[model samples]
Target: WLAKITLVENQVLLKYFVISASLAGIIFLKGAEGRICKTFSAISRLSNY
Candidate 1:
């Protein structure tokens, strides 16, 4: 039935959206972690000087 097909399409679209959002979140978290690490290293070096 047409209704069943529409439901399936909607489910697939929802899954894709969830996957993309999770990937974006992971990338953002990694970028934040890298920035924090770099900042810490710089602070330590400055302290030594």
Candidate 2:
């Protein structure tokens, strides 16, 4: 019974970890995309000038 409880706890912890990791990955990707867009716009402006 105790082993079963531990197994369940491990599963829950794994689920939480996976969720948090994915959220972090999404945020990182969005940040990188914004940076790239900003850089592109800056380059465009420079070229225009």
Candidate 3:
């Protein structure tokens, strides 16, 4: 059970990190900031829950 929980947490952390890294790409892109931020926030909320 402990290992399983840790794995899930790791997955969430990795996903969170990737989304954060995506910010740089989003900044460079033409006009996807809104969508990217929306997805990022949604995923963050899910991770918190």
Candidate of highest TM-score:
2
TM-score of each: 0.61, 0.64, 0.41
Mark the regions of model 1 whose C-alpha exceeds 4 Å error after superposition.
1-5, 39-49
Clashing pairs in 2: none
Per-residue CA lDDT of candidate 1, range 1-49, in tens?
7566787799998999999999999999999999999999999999999
Q: What TM-score does prediction 3 earn?
A: 0.41
* lDDT by residue (tens digit), candidate 2, 1-49: 7666787798999999999999999999999999999999999999999
RMSD of 3: 15.9
- In model 3, where is the ten-residue run with the lowest total lDDT? 24-33
Candidate 3 lDDT over residue span 1-49, tens digit each? 6666787798999999999889867777746777789989999999999
